[model samples]
Structures are given as C-alpha cells and as structure tokens.
Target: MTTNNNTLLCWHSKRAGVEVLVEAIKCLKNRRVLINRAIVLVQTDTDSSLYLNHEFGDIGLRFITASLENPANHNEIYQRLETSVLPELKDVANLHINVSPGTPAMHAVWLILHARGHFPSGTKLWSSQFNPDTKRTSISSVDFNVNTYLAEISAISNSEGSYALYGVDPKSAARREALATLKEFAQVPKAPLLVLGERGTGKTRLIESVVGIVKQKKVVTLACGGLDSQVVDSMLFGHVKGAFTGAETQRSGLLREAEGKVLFLDEIQDLPTSVQRKLVRVLQDNHHYYRSVGSDKEETSDFELVCASNKTIKELATTLDADFFDRISMLTITIPPLRICREDLLDDWQKIWGEVNVNPSLPKHAPTSRQLNKLLESSSLAGNLRDLKKLAFITCAYMNSYSPTEALSKAICSLQAFDDIEENEGTKFSFGDLSNTTKDELDKLFKYELARAAKRQFGTWSNAGKNLQVDQKTLQKYMKNDS
Candidate 1:
C-alpha cells in the first residue's frame, strides 16, 4: 500500500496481490490524503506490473526488480538495497515503506533496518492491515522516531517477540552489550577478534550472526583444530600441484575466498605453530602473502581474522608466542557458561523442552518441569548448550520408543558409559555387569552410539575412523552390524 509521496517499497505477496493491496490503500485513502510516487520491489520471476498499479492512475508506483526466491534470506535485503531501493531513493525527498504486503521476513527487514536508522532522513514506516469487522484497511504509519525505534527494537528482539534479531534475543545486559560490540566489530574494515568459550557455547554461532547482521565482502570459516597440519595448511593456504605426494590439484584455499572479508578460525589454539607465526606476520605487517607449498610465487589474501578457542588468552599464551597471542588477543569476548547463568537457564530449558515436546516430527509427551530439572541436574553437560540439545534428543527418542523414565535412565547411563570408557583408557566396553540386555542388544546399542558419536565428531565414517585410529572399513562394517 502506498502512503507517502516520494517512495513506497514493498515485496509482492503471492497470497495478497496488488489488487488487494490497492483495496487496502484505497480504504486508507478514505481517512486521509495519500502519496503520489512509489517504488515497488519485485522478484525477477514476478511481473509486479501485471495488475494494481493500473488502478492507481495518478500515483505511479514504479516497479524495481531483483532476483530472490526466498524473501526471508538476509542476502535478499542487501540485494534489494543495492538493486532496487537505494537506486530509486537517490533523489527522492521523502519515503514511506509499507511492509504489509510481503513475507514476514521482508516486513522484519524493513522494520529492523529502519529501527536501526538505515533509511533516508525523513522516511516513515507504515503497515496496512485489513479489518474484517470494519471490512476496511487503514494505514498505520508508525511514529518511526528515535524513541519508538529504540523501544521497539528491544521488544522485537526479545524472546517473546515475533521476530528475533538474527534468531537470538540478547536477554541480559551483558549479552546485549556483547551484541552491540559484535555489531560494531562487524562494521569495521578489519580487526582481529577472539572468542573464548566452552564447546557449543555459541562461538561459531556468533560468526554466523556476524555474517547475517553485518555487511561483509564475504565470510568463510576453518575448523583449525579438526584437521591434520598439512591438510589444514593446504585448506588455509593454497597448494600447487605436486606440493606433496597426493597433491595433484592446484586449488584455491579458504584464505583467498575470505580475502576482503571475515575469516573465522575455530579452535585457534589448535592452529599449527607455523600457521600461528604466519598469522602474526599478517597482523604485524597488515598483509597476507603466502607461497604454495611447492610453488615459488607468493599469493596475497587481505582478510580480517576472527579466532575462537575454548581456552583463555593466558592459557593460550603458554603454548603460543607472546607476539602471536597478543595480536590474536586484541579483542576477546567470552561466553559465560550456561551453568553460571542461572537467571536465563530455566527460560532456555523451558523453550528447548517445549520445542521438543510439541514437534510433530516426534511423538508428543508433556514432560513436567520437575522431571526435566532432574535430567538437567544429573547431566554433566558442563555448560555446553549442545549437551542440553543432545539430552532433549535422547528424551524424545525414549519418549517416542520407550518411556520418560527410560529416557532419564538412558541419559544418565550414557554419561556413565562415557566416564567408564575414559577410565578404561578407550578399551572395548565390558557389558558383563550391565543387566539391561542380551549380547545382541548390547552390540546393537554400541553400534547405535558409535554411529551417533562418529556423526557428531567428524560427520563421516572415514573422518571419524581416522580420528579414532580405526579403519573406515571397520566402521562401515560395524554400522552394518545393525541398530
């Protein structure tokens, strides 16, 4: 619906076409005067001019096109801004964006960017909603001032709100402050950042957040601790053909892809010592030049580095040189463990539990708060959010196939099994005293757990086998032994 004179930007809704949008605008026009000009954003596949604008004869709502199958994609917002909105708004004196006629995500993008003060100086935001009782729709131009923008941003990004900012709510003051810092960091041209946290405490998740919320040339990641030194080096720095016995292809590395953007190196403590030195050199000289393992020619990749580790800067300094650590430890952010964040734990637990219980993909079972508390209290999650998710998965599996009590028992049993295996120094398990099942059942259970662990650790049997010092063929055979 068009409200202001200069420009009105909106996405074409498959459900409610421009005719309905025009009807809504007409109803709003009954109450007050309307704008004369507009610029409608449309997908490449859609001919937004098919209808509706014809009826608004005096008001020419010009159509601008961008290719977007999913309006919800954050990338679409950038595409829209670049290809449509910014180009159209160059000389426009005022603007009003009607977000009523698009996808929920489209509406959110409009509201969020405007709330973040991204639009032209006098741009106003409004929504047109049809009223069944009144059989009419009217323009509700939000005050769209600094006061409402700030207030609405907090409310909209809060847990209870319909739209979460990048799918996360900054509930506490600390988290809110961290989010602010992250956003600011995202805007900077280049800066090294460090995130210290336990596994699954959202170090990688924040990297994703930066990609979504910030405009970057590109974003790439490397799991520094997960690969062999040579493999890691080849992945980070390109290798020429014949670099090593198996190096047959001259491949471009992630560093090149990350050039002029963000390069997230996860588990930075495990990064190779040689790589650490090279990285320090990059920071020291503000240049990223590397030679392929066998090639004499040097290559350059100018990128901002962000590193994450489950160790503190002090702990890292013991293993890494002071210079390397100092360059990396420039801007460090620590994620507090869930165990210590008692204030937010219950809320987090409730949301997680509710999601599991209500999911149509799983059998429905309402777990009591007290019962859930027992599971949480007994779990040695050690503040890892992934553990809570794993527990939820286990609970659902048991609730679907067995019982809640059985779920709780299995959850505790799995933890005990891990402890026993660790104490036994990774020796084959002994099912002698385990009274729950026959040999066949025990074998099946072991296979199931092994498969699950392998998937989590390496995502493929071959990688898992290599990590576990077992042959991939052996793992494949074990998987075939059945569930």
Candidate 2:
C-alpha cells in the first residue's frame, strides 16, 4: 500500500522546522513511496508554511493552517482534521500520514484517529527515526493494533476515576465488564453499534463517552420512538424543497448533519419497518449511499451509526426487518441495570448530589456526609439512576429551607410513599379489593408526589408540566391539593 502513497500528510514542528518533513520525504522516496502531493499543517500565526511551500511547491504542496499553539487541545485538532483534512484526502486511496513532525499530543491524536478507524482502510502511519550510527533517518510504519491497544488500556480505564469521567460510577464487576466491552466496541468506528439497556441505566451517557473518544464532535441524535414512517424517512434521508407538504425550504436531515460524526438513534426498535428497509441499504457497505425523499441523485454521508434500545436483541428481531436488524446488530453492548449493580447506588447518589449542588439555577446548599448517607440508606433506589438523582434533588431542595435532619426525614418519607404508589400502579382496584375512599386517597397521594417530583426534576412548574404531559394549571391544582 505504501508503494501507491501519493499524499504525504504531516504537521510542521516549530523546533525541527521543515527538516522533519524533508527527512520523511527522503525516506519515503528511498522506500519507493511516490509522493505526488504533500499536505502540511502549519501554525496559523506563522509564515513558515509559505517558505516550506516555496521549497516544496513543485511537489504539489498544500498548507492547512491550524491554531495549534497549545497542541494539547485534542478536540480542536481532531475537528480541523475531520472537517478540512479528511474531506480533501477522501479520494486518496492509499494515503500516508507522516507522524515524524508535531508535538507528542499531535502524534497521539493521529494514532487514536487511525486506531478508531477514522483513517481509510489502506492508510499507513509512518514514523521516522534518526540513526546516529548510520547518520541517516529511517522510516517505518507504526504497527499499532486497535484491539490490542484497547486491551492494554482496559486495566487503566476500569477504575472508578475513569468511569466518573463519563458521569457514571461502575462500582460492580458487571458494570466494569460492560465498560470494557464498550471501550472495545468504540474502536470500530464505522460499524453499526447497538446499546441495550433498561430505562435509567445510563445508556445515553455510555454512548456519549464512547462516541466522544471515537469522534470528537457532538453526536447528532434522533429519537425514533413515536415517530411515524413518513416523518422518520424525511428526517433521516432529508427532503427536497417540494418533497413533502410542510418540508418548508429544504431539509438536510440528521444523517447529512451527522457526516463525519456519530448518529445516535435512541429507541431504534420503534423505527417504522418501511424506514428500516431504507436504512439497510444506507448501512450495508463501503459504497453505501442514500437518495433524498424527492431526488433521484444519490447522496453520500460518512458517519458512524449508534443505535440504542431498552429491548433485547431477541425482542428487536421480532419487531425489526430481518436484514435491517442484521445489519445494525454488527456490534452490540448490553448495560446491566442498577438492580444488578446495586453496589453503585451510593456512588451514583453522591455524583448526582455533587451535580445538583453545583447547578447555578438551583439554590446552592451543602449537606453533611452523614446526612447524605442516612438519606441514601433510607430512600429506595430501585428506580435506578433516575430515582437516585431525583432523591438527591429533592433532598437538596429540602436542605435549602429546612434543617439537615428535617430534610432527611422528609426525603425518606417522600420516597417511601412514592415507591408504594409506583409499586401498586398497575393493580386492579375494584370496590371488593379496595374501597372507593382508599382508592381515591392513593390516587390523590400519587398525583401530589408525582407533581412534586416533577417540580424537583425540572426547576420550574412550566417545565414540569411540559415534561409530565400535564398542563401548568393541572400541576398547580395538584400542588394546591397537596398544600
């Protein structure tokens, strides 16, 4: 593959100047690697690229200005390469990335990008080393394996500190194993990855962290739940000006917006079968492309597809189109629910507490460790991370106005009462099984508790109403009845 290398891509080092690039070119030439074009990343504030361009202009030199004074800014560097560099090199089949120049951070970014499969299949990463004994520089391809690298670093990332980076506390063996699986899956950049987890099991958070590493841009997300066939099709494949009745001007769609990034389809099992068939073709192979709703010309978008569902693969198979399900099931990750990893409850509670305390919109109040521990032990966390966070928010609200002891007391009682209502939510309540008066009391109690929980979850009554699917007046009525 190196024999067909027509592009020499590298970053210009300030200290080494153009010597590193020149040495790499010489070594490539010696190795019979044809360099028809040289793409160099130079500092935006420097004229060094002009001089280097003057010297290498005959070799089709192209300069990409990078504001990389602080080479440690990996996000900026990765974005620049994704938006500017990679697009330019898409046509270069056998590209070579010279890692001889730039800072240590820059070199790491290249390896990460390559290991994560951001580079094309035939791309080579070359490293040049100077041999003092021979008074010459030799070039060699870095033999880095993505799976092997992930294995070597698994030990380091298995700790609580690393998991905390993703706003999760994987304290149990099951959670640690799940995280390891996720890290390995992240190495396969383009393969469609499916995440299976119950509600409030942190599936979205896990995807965010994994996608953050593989792709440095924000994920483009579309919730497929409750969306009809036409809506899903127009959203994913976009539409021309007159494609649909109310498409307005033109819609580029989530798939187009997700080019060079990750597209997370939440609750993917809910996607209509008609749209699922269309996606099978878009996700099949290297030549995958999609046609817009009203256009015949095929359009291409290069993106990583990540799907998530609360249902298991078996459940998904029953509902999804066979081919579409098979295509997206290329890689799967299952996250154990909080019930299985109950040991993480306290840690998860603390993390939520810390976030609530720091939130600028919430009244800042610190609770004693003893109070927090007492509250955690007394409250029910069976609802998973969501319930634990809600408990923390409610406790924080109490602490803002009440004594620490009183806040703990109120929080425990509230959670226990809420848990009772939730536990009995689906049971039959005929007059023989339960009196009308008792049923009315439970209904009223459940409504008040739900209203209060919503208020705590969302800072304002308006937001609470919108999220709870109730009108502001209804929520106000519930609050008034409670008072």
Candidate 3:
C-alpha cells in the first residue's frame, strides 16, 4: 500500500481513542487544512482492522499496519514512511505528520521525524486517549487553550467553595466580610487590578471568584513563569504571520483575546525583562502596538491587566527593570497565609472534604480540643493553603484506614518524623518548640518555622531559603548564628 510520510495517521479502535483523534484533528484543522492525504495508523488487531476496513474504507482514507506481536518491526514501517513515502509528497505545501494510538513504533516514528524537523513548522502534535473521561488532551506546544484548561480545572476543583480564606471566620464574621468585599469589588468600575500574596495562598481562587463576580468580563489567565522571552512576547502581544520561527499564520495574543475583559497573569515576576517593559508601556499609554511575525504592519490593542505574584512588589522591582515597576499602580491586596488564620481550619477542612470523591461511609472527625490547640500552636505550613489542603487530603485518606484516634496518632508520628529527621541531619533548632519567648521574640519564632519548613521541603539551606522568600546569603547567616 502507498503511504505519505508528510500525511500522519491516527489509529484508534475505541470511543475514547476516537474522541482524542477528533480533538487532535480539530486543533490541526483549525490551524490549517491537510490536503496531501492522511491515514489512521492501526494495529493488526481484529477490532482496529475491522473498524478501519468497514467504517473508514469508503472515505478513501489510508491504513498502515505494523505487527503488534513484535514491536521491533515498527522500525521497518517507519523507514518506509520516511524514506519512500514522504519524498513523494515533497511538493505539497504545508506538509504535516501525525500518528494515532498504536504501538511503540508509531511514537518512534514521530520522534524521529520531529528530531529531523521533517514536519511542517508550527505543527501541533498530540497524544490520543490521554484521559477520555476528563476529555483531557495533551498538546506538544503551549496554546491559548492551555489557559482554558487551567481555568476549567480551577473552576471545577473550587466550585464548591470548600476552602476558606485564611483570615476569615467560616460562618459569621469572616465569611460575611470577605463576601461583602468581593461583591463590592465586582461592582466597581472595571480597571486594572493586582492581587499580591505569598505562594500557595489561594490568590488564584480569589481572582477566579472575582472574575465570576464580574459576569460581563472575559478572563484570560497566563502563567509568566519559565516561558521563553519570544513566546511570552508573542503570547501577550499578537504576532503577525512570519513574525518569528514557526509562525505560519497571524495570531491574536492573550491581550487581544481579553479585550474589554480581564487579563490575569500568574507569577508576574517571571515575565522577561523585555516583555515587562512592553507591558509597562501598555499600562501607561493604555495602548500598545505589536509587529506581525513577517508583516510590516503593527496592530494596537487595549485590555485590563490583573497581575498576581508571590514575590513582594518591592522585591520584584529589584529583579525587574525600573520602567516596568514604574507602570504598575500601587493598588494591591494581600492575601494572608493559612497559619495566620488557624481558627478557620475546621471550616476549610469540611469545605474541601465535601468536594473530594471518597468513601461515603467514612466518618467525619473534627479536630479534638487538644488537637486544635496543637495545630494552632504549630507553624510548619510551608505552602500555605495548598499545603493545608494536601494535609487534609492525607488526613482523610488515613481516617479511612483507621479510627480518628489512630489517624491522629499517625499524623503525630509523621510530624515527629519531621522533627527526628531534622535532628538527625543536624538542622537548626525550631523556635516554636523552644521555651521562654517574649512578645518581641515571637517574630523570630515565625522565621524559625518558615526556615525549618523550607529546609524540610527543599532538603538544603539555599533552596529552602528561596521558599522562605529570602536570600541564600541571609539564610546562611541565620544558619551560622544558630540563635
């Protein structure tokens, strides 16, 4: 049978496989039309072969088969597609390659083609049947829809409002106060806003809730961490066709996508220096222009920018260019960490536990008076609300396997294990466990807990110091002094 290497085949027999293939095809078709003819690469299995023959045969689609009994034979099939097939389709504009669910040979073929850059530039690769129930799909490169997935997950996991903010009372005062503020904020004339907090402090949840409150606005979220300068620039500012490498078509960036809406940026501190400068320009002038990939024309767009970060603005300013910091307005709201509001643990626990899928018969165990006192007194929460939720989940799992008393005992044992490990490794002493602390010395206690938690999580002073939101040199100084 004749095959085209530039034409990729997606092979799947079941519903889940087909769904993934459809989604993948949708993503590709939205970008460009494939005309060189494509095939669904299927195995020699009965179901797949029959499906291909009966269901897709009339469509004039091609089917390439490789032996499933011996995965090693896939190399031969790959050679045929690469050497014999792709050469024939060289004249086809926008030659592309894709593969469906099949043997290891299919994946190998893709990897070889990708390494050799044989596929068309800007080609989006996908894996089929990643999670059928969740309707989850994986794309090789980041796309606008990736933010949509993050927003969807955040919405689903948090819809039940199971976790309470740190500083709020669950039922009466705190809940009422927070909700009142949120409602008021929603009613205000829409403008650029900023949410500031330490890592894992539920800033995203608060921002999402606010977005929901502002019903008329579209929310486009972006994480600025670990992205390349060029990608970040293109993502925030629409790029024209041929603007850069792999830019096959003109595309609107998030700023344009979120016009007359909210552009929520997470980890704003990680935005590159050049992008930061551009953003500053946008904020100050309320208008900015972006050059298309290969076009000479520049497009101007406007939008509301909402930025969130774990780093303090002062600290971020030190790392970023002055012009960027100058453009960011001083209106900021800080979300307190979980340890500050130990009184709301029960409400938070109940809220989160209700949303989790668990055995219905599992008994709900509220913390005992003594346990509450101990938890309130302890300060080992390294990751704020995120850590607390994880602890709650672990506690719930343990409760399923044992009685409340037993589960509490297990938790105590784990906390003690943390202590034992620190002692064995000659880590610094914890101030909370120390005696005779005056009011003036209480701040030192908080610092000790922060440092200890950072060290435990990172296993080294330097990394732990980063988590503690301090410099490595300062952490070394603290370690050397051994207060």
Candidate 4:
C-alpha cells in the first residue's frame, strides 16, 4: 500500500485512555505514514488535551471539545460533528480518519457521513487495534466500499445554508450578497484581493472562509501597522546574511513562505510608501520576480495576495499610493458595520457572550430578551461589532451581582459616553449627562476629551501642554486611562 502525509481525524477514548491515541499515532509513524496534523475530538477536561499537545504538538495535533449528551446516540453525535468538526475541514487536504478510538455509534456516523458524501471525495478510513497478550499495536485500512451502502441509504440533502456554516444570519440580505461575492472570487486564482471594513468587522474571518472554500493548504499573514519601513521591507521580501546592521543569518520572508498559497497583509493602509512602490512592481510583472534587499539574484513567488484595511475606499485612496491601490483593488469585499446591520447584533451578542461564559454550571449572566431589545434600541454602537462584544463581556462580568437590565444599561452608557465633542458643546455642559456618572468618572472623561482636542488642534503634546498650561505627562496619563 502507498500512503502520504495527511491530516488525521479521530476521537480520544476516555475508557482506554489517551495512551491508545498515542500508540495509534506511533504505529502510523512507524509505518512511514507522515501524519502532518491530527484533529482529536475530546469529551473530557483540558488535561487530556494538554497531554496530547505535549506529546505530538510538533506534528500539529489539535483538539476539538465535543461535549456530547449521549455519545451512543447517532442523532446527537451527528449534529455535534456537523456543527463543529466540519467547519475545521475547510483547508484540510488528504484527510485520513482513525476509527478505532470512538464508540460503535460514533464509528457508524463516520461511515454514514462518508456514504452520504459529506467527507472529501477521496478521504481514507483507517483502524488500529492493540493486542493484550502480545502488547502490540497494529494498523489497517477500513476499506469498505461506500458506494454499496449508498444504494440502501438515502443521501442527506444539502439543506445547510451557505452562511449557516459560518454562524452568520441567513435572513441578512447584505451579508448574504457579500458572502456570495466572496464565493465567486475564491474560484479565480492569482488576482489581488482587497477587504474593506471598520474595526471589529471580522475581515480576516471572511477571508479564511474564502480560502476554505477553495481548499488552499497554507496561509501566511502579517499586520502591516506600526512596523518600521526597513523592517517591513525585509520581512516581506527576505534578506541575505549580513543584509543590515543586526543581521546574523539569512531570512526567508513571508512572500517566499507563501509560495503557491495565500498571503494576507492586514492594515495595508499603514504600509509605508516605499514598500508600496516595490510591491506594485511585483504585482505588475507577469512572473512576479523581485530581488532581495541585499542580494543581486532575482527570485519569484507566485502567491495569492489578500490585503485588508479598516479604512473606507476614500480614506484608503488618501493614505495609500495610487498605483498600489489600483493593483489590490482587482477584487474587493466590503463588510458592513454593525450599526447598519442592527438585526444581526442579537445573534452576535449571544455568540460572543456564550464564548465568554463557557462554564455551563455557572448561573446565566444574560439580560431578559425584552431588556436586551430595549438596550439595543437606545445605544449607539460606533465601534460596531467590537462595541457589542465589549457589552457582552461587561454583562457577563457584572450580571451575577447586579440586575441584568442594569448591567446592560451601564455597559451601553459607558460605551456611548466617549464621542467626539462638538465645538458649541464645549461652552455648555448638561447635569443630565452626569446623572449616572460618578465625579471621578466625569473628571477622567473631562481630561481625556480635553487632551484629545488639544492634541488635534496643536498637533503635538508639547505644544498642547504649553497652550493649555498643563503638564505633558498629565495629559499622557489621562489618555492612557481613557481606555
């Protein structure tokens, strides 16, 4: 039999201990089967996961926490697998399933999914057995023809909505259209792509979904914000040994590493002008060849480019070079902010809160449905998804001690309190605005707004402090605690 490196998917057996999983992986390794990664479904606590990671983390062992109510029930197991396990298979290649560690019902669902055309077309199934008397572990293929079972069992319908797999609302027309555009763009290869959205709009997540749809094997990413110009150039294009003052060894940069895969550049608007000029040349070339910073030799990398920015198109045009902007705009995806898509905020809040409050035994730390609706109706979420998530975190932390409605209201008030002040409002203040606010909180807000307005008007901390007759350090302190 011929075998190659592939991703292994299996369940961790509680009865037999993770030793069974370790030995099974060892058996495959001995057979010269290069299992590059494993997705182990674990039902127990984090200790077992830690043990597995300690053992085979070099080979990329990953765990999925699947807390099943009835492990033996087919329906329950199938639903759990569909929701959690299937989403992770987006970028998987040459998938191999180990069927030895799970229950008979669990094993049956694996085969059912195979017969129902759920797994990738060429997925292989393997089983391992441990001999008690001989104390030896053996492996073999579970090579039953799924086609034979297909005649007896009806195929499952593809009833899952396109956005349903991504935890997005199917009822949202704007989101549905954006997803459709992404799906169409994923099929076209080697075109530069641009993703535009406000902060916390999940631009990276949307791109990952596209990569999964195309089944790309590798993804390399870098956030271009706040990086020095020379450092960003060397990091993207690589450098030879002794290329700079601190260089002791040669470096293979992100472009070379992302060969034949996806390269994601986040905060592209912050990339320096010099690097943008070089990158524009690389994109315009037919072969995409460029020289390293110090090397005379020219090299080539044919990787797909995906760039994201939190700025609008108009803002990006002002920040980025015109040629660079035109090249990356070959394909574009824009994520709508949460304020316009308010209907989606409910689902987003529930998901974010559920993630924050992971312990099921803890009392529910959520507002009543009516109270939540009223809170959303009154709040202005300028930070979009970020603000909604922050509200969830605040509610989860304070709801146990305070009334849920009060917790949510306080969270909204805190978020809405920090808006840019108007010129006329600087002269007049309202006591109504200070009703629920403490004196200390009001003082902090006052300092924060004053410092920001001064900085904006004067364009420097020293000038602002001199003009306001305040110490520079005190202005900086106020800005630090404004968070």
* Number of clashes recorded per candidate: 0, 0, 13, 0
Model 2 lDDT per residue over 188-218, tens place? 7678889998888878866776555545556
- Which candidate wins on TM-score? 4
Off by over 4 Å in 1: 1-137, 140-167, 215-217, 350-368, 373-380, 401-483
**Candidate 2 worst ten-residue window by lDDT:** 151-160
Candidate 2's C-alpha runs over 4 A off are: 1-169, 359-382, 428-483
For candidate 4, write residues 140-213 as lDDT tens digits.
Answer: 88877656222111111122221212243233676667766776776678788788888978787667555533
lDDT to native, each model:
0.64, 0.72, 0.57, 0.71
Query: Model 1 over residues 1-483: C-alpha lDDT tens digits?
Result: 434565556666677667655765564466464657656667753567466436677777677776576677876675566445653553465676787786777777777666654455566787788788997667777765554333333333332323223223334565566666766665665667777877767667666555334643455888887677788778887789989989988978887888777888888888888777766766775677776667798778888888888987679989777789988787777776654343345445544554455457653333445655644443335546666656666777776666667775676566546644554574345446678778887877587568546634454555578788888777777666643
Model 1 root-mean-square deviation: 17.1
Worst 10 residues of 3 by lDDT: 142-151
lDDT of 1 at 421: 59
Q: Per-residue lDDT tens digits of candidate 3, residues 89-150?
A: 33333444444455566667665554444443434455443565886664443222222222
Error of 4 at 462 (Å): 42
Candidate 4 — which pairs collide?
Answer: none
Arranged by TM-score with the best first, the candidates are 4, 2, 1, 3
